[model samples]
Target: MEQDLGIALPLDYKELLTRFPGGVFRRIEIDSPVANEKAWTKYKRALDELLEILGDEDLEYLDKVDYTPC
Candidate 1:
């Protein structure tokens, strides 16, 4: 799935998916990096909604974060 996405997921994220393949947690919807077709579509929809809420200003602020590896 990571290969299909063309990005390597964080180790912890990979571990979490391994622990819970369906990606459900306490009945809350947590987007899975390894989601199947249906789950991926749902994830994308949620992401689009989140992006809409974030707007350009919020995204610019987020882009300024120092994502450098420790």
Candidate 2:
């Protein structure tokens, strides 16, 4: 279930995903660095869940985040 992405996910992210199966990530348009970080900090758990699903090999429980098609 591992590919060589060469990027390390933040600590506790996996745990958060495992704990909350309903979590999700919000694709941020980082126009404002301070605001984006603050928002991300508040929704860190959701981001972790999104990462978990994206990284998971099991498709049974994996759910993609909803985004508008451009």
- Name the candidate that leads on lDDT: 1
lDDT of 1 by residue, 1-70 (tens): 6665577878987798778776457897666645678877777677668767666554556577655222
Please provide, for model 2 over 1-70, each residue's C-alpha lDDT reduced to its tens digit, 9 standing for 90 to 100.
Answer: 0122356655576556445444334864332212345554546555567777666655644356454222
Clashes of 1: 0
Model 1 local distance difference test score: 0.67
lDDT of 2: 0.47
Q: Number of the top candidate by TM-score?
A: 1
For candidate 2, which ten residues in a row score worst on lDDT?
Answer: 28-37
lDDT score, candidate 2, position 58 = 53
